[model samples]
Target: MSKFFTYLALGLLWLLHWLPLPAFVAIGRGLGWLLFWLAAPRRKVVRINLKLCFPHLSEAERERLAKDHFAMVARSFLERSILWFAPEARIRRLVRFKNQERFDALVGQPVILLAPHFVGLDWGGARIAMSYDCASMYAHQKNPILDKWLLHGRTRFGDQQLLSRQDGVRGIARALKAHRPFYYLPDMDYGPRDSIFVPFFGVQTATISGLPRLATLGRATVLPVVTRALPNGAGYEVEFGEPWTDYPTDDLEADTRRMNAEIERWVLTMPEQYYWVHKRFKTRPPGEPRIY
Candidate 1:
């Protein structure tokens, strides 16, 4: 039954992708809002996340944001699918990078590209790697078929995909030394493995510290970048933030805290766009029991 539904969903999605861009965009936007209100599991998750993060917000306000979030998520879903299936010419027309040379200059250097869970950031990474050497570290999705398809689509532009866990510390280090840019989404909460609790939207959250440690150890520059959703069904803004040249200290924990702080600042700038549905504070702080 599950497999049947999966194929049916995929078939419909393919048909949607085949439609004219404007039509697909309209349908996708509508579907996102529909799912936001109609899907029980998604609504529950969104509600829980919102309630936890914005305790001060009225229930009505949180519900409104959750609805907007669903719309954005739905739009992102269609946009990303289009990103995969859309032709190069159309994709190029969709998103543009400012200060691309800053990225261009690092074509030969080992660097960590920190992308928060913003719109089209993955698309921006793919575009950047087309002209330079780059690889991205992503949490492997559980569905084997979807994972395989995603891997093929992402690497179609020449960027390598590094599975977050399987790649291990050594593999990532090797990729760094190769002197090509590495892409990592900074907002994911993987586990309690060497992470530090940092203030994210005034809530203490556990975050992955691998990027800063790798940058400091490998002597690589860490550049903060975000791809924002643009108005209309067009492209997005691939804005590059200031690069981290100073690097973190030898203390792994201190460096990790600093990295989390930086990522938190970026997410706060665009609270609605960040993947708030994720249980970021799932991992409990020391001495506390698990909450979710």
Candidate 2:
């Protein structure tokens, strides 16, 4: 099934690349509607996540957040598609940087650039690769056409791409050894072994341990970054936070928990912007039922 989707994605990539800019955006919007409004996989997932995260919010508020989440998802998809095919000048014009010099200072050092799953995340990753040799891990989409197209777009700025389930540590080590920054979405669930249960949105949720592991192995500075969508529905603000000074203890589980907690802290700053579509609480700890 994955192979079949790969083939389909390849075809879509061909069609999308050849299409005019407006046409590409049209196609993107259509796909967004299907996935976000009609099919609504992410919206459904987010609704469950929101209910868990904001239990105190009224039913009407939860419903509003769910609807807003879907709209944000749709807007993000279309803007990302535009980034894929748009000219470099156009992309630069749309995406602005705030407090980026701090990030620039860490270029030579092995850095674990942490980014939330926001609207312009791919573009932010691309911007990093363009400035410095960088590698990022992306979850493989079921649609082959979409996956290939996404990889093609991500690698366009000369950064290598790694699948999430691949030898993530090894790939990251190679990038670090070469003094290239390694990027990954630390908020999502990886698997039972690769993750640890941590407090998120007032519940213990499973989160990938890659950030802590990578930071420890490479002695990398963990920098939190977020790319927020602007009101015009076209531009972005790529904001970078200060690096984490605290190091993990000898215990892996404790360190993982600390790392996930830091991520949760930053994510709540713009809770509405989080990629709530993810099944964040998919893997519960022993004796606990899955939250979603």
lDDT agreement of model 2 with the native? 0.71
Segments of candidate 2 deviating more than 4 angstroms: 1-37, 40-42, 139-143, 159-164, 251-254
After the best TM-score superposition of candidate 2, give how far the Cα of residue 273 lies from its true spot, in angstroms: 2.0
Model 1: lDDT of residue 198: 72
Error of 2 at 88 (Å): 0.5
TM-score list, all predictions: 0.88, 0.83
lDDT of 1 by residue, 96-207 (tens): 8887777767767888888887656667776665656676776676777677667766776755656466767666677878876778776777888867787666667787
- Model 1: lowest-lDDT 10 consecutive positions: 16-25
Task: Give the alpha carbon lDDT tens digit for every residue of 1-292 in model 2.
Answer: 5777656744555455444334534454556546666765666788788888889988889877766666566655645555576667766766778899988888888887888777568768766666666777777887666777788788877646564656657777877777777776777776687767777777887777777778888888888887876653556678888877776456777777776666667666666667888787788889986565
**Candidate 1: RMSD to truth:** 2.5
Candidate 1 has an lDDT of 0.72
